[model samples]
Target chain A: MANDSDGIDIDYVANLARIALTDQEKERFSGQLGDVLKYIEKLNTVDVSGVEPTAHAFPLENVWREDAAEPGFPVETALKNAPAVRRNMIAVPKVVE
Target chain B: MSDPLYYRTASALSRELEAKKISSLELVRAVIERTRAVDGTVGAFISFDEDDALARARASDARREGGEALGPLDGIPVGIKDILAVEGQPLTCASRMLGDFVSPYDATAIGKLKAAGAIPWGRLNMDEFAMGSSTENSSVKTTANPWNTDCIPGGSSGGSAACVAAGEAPLTLGSDTGGSIRQPAALCGVVGMKPTYGLVSRYGLVAFASSLDQVGPFAHTVEDAAILLQAVAGYDRRDSTSYKTDIPDYRAALQENRGPWKLGIPSEYFGEGLDPEVEKAVRAAIDFYRKEGCEIVEVSLPHTEYAVGVYYIIATAEASSNLARYDGIRYTHRSSEATDAIDLYFRSRAEGFGEEVKRRVILGTYVLSSGYYDAYYLKAQKVRTLIRGDFLKAYNQVDALLTPTTPAPAFRKGEKTDDPLRMYLSDIYTIGANLAGIPGISIPCGFSGDGLPIGLQILGRPYQEADLFAIARRFEEAHDYHAKHPGL
Candidate 1:
């Protein structure tokens, strides 16, 4: 289920991504992403030892705001764009029997 | 003949509105007419509410008539890239996932624009989820380069740039993640700036790569861009990452901070793959500054070659995580064919996302997948550190770094769509600034042999946008490139 070609297992990765790719899309993406991965291997040439990872350009500590409740979106506004609304709540398919 | 009202810069329009020579309603009508006349070919707008725009314009006119105008941006109509939430406006990221979705609230940037008396006019198009370098990835429509309708307006801020270039709007807001704003602005021959990472709050901007994403402006001139930037910049509690520095008056700084400053030209950016015309124009610009008593120094970014590679890995990895919220449950397109919850996640994303978005998500998922994190994602982050270090080291010696915004001018539609690698390389020159988390501005430097516009990019230190704008304004004052508009 993994590492079929180009170091990316299409089925395994697609499953992880929660995407159901068509066969044609899988083929096209596999070849294209393979080229990108090959290009990305250039990162291997850099000596990154002792270099710190930069998650953001600037550093900041934990940002804390006053723990007070403020008015939020009303129920109708919150559900305005919901695909399925039931009794002012988003309704999803049944997950458990 | 005089230029049309739609083609005038916002600064000039502001003075006209103050003198009662033109009403905001008149200007809005002229812009609406221009959009109707040319957007058929440009495809810059996804949707615009004419009555809403007119009503806002009338309110602005009333404020002016009462001598209670807000500021420079009052009565000005700025186009909004669809990536930012404009309350009640369609918040499509040019993706089918949110095709019918309406914004529940205004983005912090939009709130500031409203407070400044600026009307957020229309929803501009972009690459789906702000993923591609070209607007061709937009599921709604491909925004053509207004300079030559056959070519792409470089994206994911293509519509923001195109509308200004097409004279449909005097100003626009665009999010830059890995050169989304600057690259398109380069292609379309307008002034676009990406402020320092935390300069403008990103509260309502749909996340692409959170670390790299920033909100900035597209306008006809550096002065106008400064005006627009002034309106939306400042700290907000909602966006904790936003900087808390004192906000400078960018427009006033343009005139006050004149300098024969030292500018750096990175040698790595001048090598192979750069179109000779772009290089020639950029070199000429360097020579222009040199003749104006500014010193030009050659610097090395060293890791420039790895930028595209580093960007793709990091940006897609973040995008994959940020976009996971679209699971057909809340405000996104739900699959009609789903039988179960998991099936809904799979089928809805499969059907809703465009081709490029799907490719990036799968690739991102693979890199962050178990056993591959250290090899791909972690390594990319380390390399990102080196890239940022390179810019910081260069800044220690020079006021700013100058380079070509893109390798070449705009390419014909469908040229690079087949090869994702080729398309990724289009942002090579502009990606470094984003990775470094610094401010970058793209101004029209020259035109290609084919009549396409070329951009000269200026990269400045983090939170030093005023100095950058001042430097850009100096170059702009000596050239008429910014004043030139595309003939539609």
Candidate 2:
């Protein structure tokens, strides 16, 4: 796990996460990528025989609450903390031109 | 002001509330004052609603005056983890994404707590979307350990653990994706229980990793946690993953006397990477348990080594999918200068999510995407089965598995921040239980040389929290670990 093969594109990850990482951060994180990948590789050795793969720790079951309508928070109070709003609705800057 | 009640367990507080010795308002006030004083240093709370809490406490007092019987936790102030939704409150998982997202409804756990007369004090801090092991990942602020201000409070439930340790709240609600609850609890010297996966409902918890996430309680004592769990655990129709099984009275289960019990020490847990001080503290705990009439045996969890690897793949995959909802349209933050709605989705998500979250999202997308799905995601699931099998195999021969909760005591805030892999390794001793969906608890064993707390984790079979609590309680009763405070 070194900078020997195709390096993990730190810039691509930074773009995905939207943070402007300093050059040092990119270099440091890039160098450490191999260790992360290598550690995950170690998990391949476990022998899973006759064991059912569990997506959830509990047996797959539906937890349903009553369908009856309950009183909800008033819209005025609910929207009180909105950082940005317009005409009783949470407003965000116009995304589509 | 009879006795000025300091360090009262949730159970004891409930008993006092029923006995009419302490008014709910007084308790609420005391907790608010304590939180105000220490929260500045601990950074436990992102938001503390003192006025609302007092209002609720006064109402509870009115109920008592009107001869209306209150619930078990009637008027006990509980710090809610920011990840759980509280109706009409901001449900920020310590991230900029949901900085303004208000929950229209209460989470099932919060509803249950309210029904039990537990006053919601405030939203505690946590890792952004419960991603990292330390509270440093929290976009809001880092939660400092009460024991030492410089050291980190283990996270993504770091604030919850810190609040309990600092005596700001007698009990706090936290969610465990991996060791989010147990690890922080250990580091902060408090009792944290990750109930059997389905024991608590996930109806209103903001999803981090859906498959692995479960809400649990953090408290100063095991009985306090048990009492809180009794009120919160049960089937919820809203949460499809919630169990339909009967909700047993966990408090009663704890009261059942215990004698000799089978305890398994997984060899892999005691191997290299464990700090010498943590090892000594855990060994002393095991010895104490043995003296309390428990049979200790060496057990092998052959797949234990693969736990962290399997957990990362599965948790990241789920996180990637679950977090897809944050594309800026229906809820929370949207970027200002997007050229179109599609750009809004992409730009908002890219800007709103923190670095760690984006890293995970990308990793998850890579694993679950078209070509690599079978190779990474499916393979990880197969290994997850083996990890569960290992637990089942060991449980067949022993009653419970005991191990150190963390590799070391609370580390300094910036110690592993630069090294992501080293930080991930901290969860090595804890991720297996989440993978296997078994119940585990972290109880304070002793302190390190520098006086930071050390925790011993006890893992039990699915739905065997009763046995785990019994063993943990017995150990607590015999040893004085719970009695020692951080001198905050």
Best by TM-score: 1
TM-score for all models, in order of appearance? 0.99, 0.92
Expressed as tens digits, the lDDT of each residue in A1-97 for candidate 2 is: 1112234566765555344455765676566655676677765555455556677665574444568899766778667665566888987655445
Winning candidate number (lDDT): 1
In the range B175-283, model 2's lDDT, one tens digit per residue, is: 9989999999999999999988878999899888888888999998888988888889998877777777887777788877575798999999999999999999899
The true-versus-predicted C-alpha distance at residue B282 of model 2, in Å, is: 1.2
| DockQ for the candidates, in order | 0.68, 0.35
Summing lDDT over every window of 10 consecutive residues in candidate 2 chain B, give the lowest-scoring window: B1-10
The per-residue C-alpha lDDT of model 1 at residue B449 equals 96
TM-score of chain A of each: 0.92, 0.64
Candidate 1 to truth, TM = 0.99
Instruction: List model 1 lDDT by residue over B120-212, tens digit each.
Output: 989999999998888999999999999999999999899999999999999999999989999999999999999999999999999989999
Clashes of 2: 7
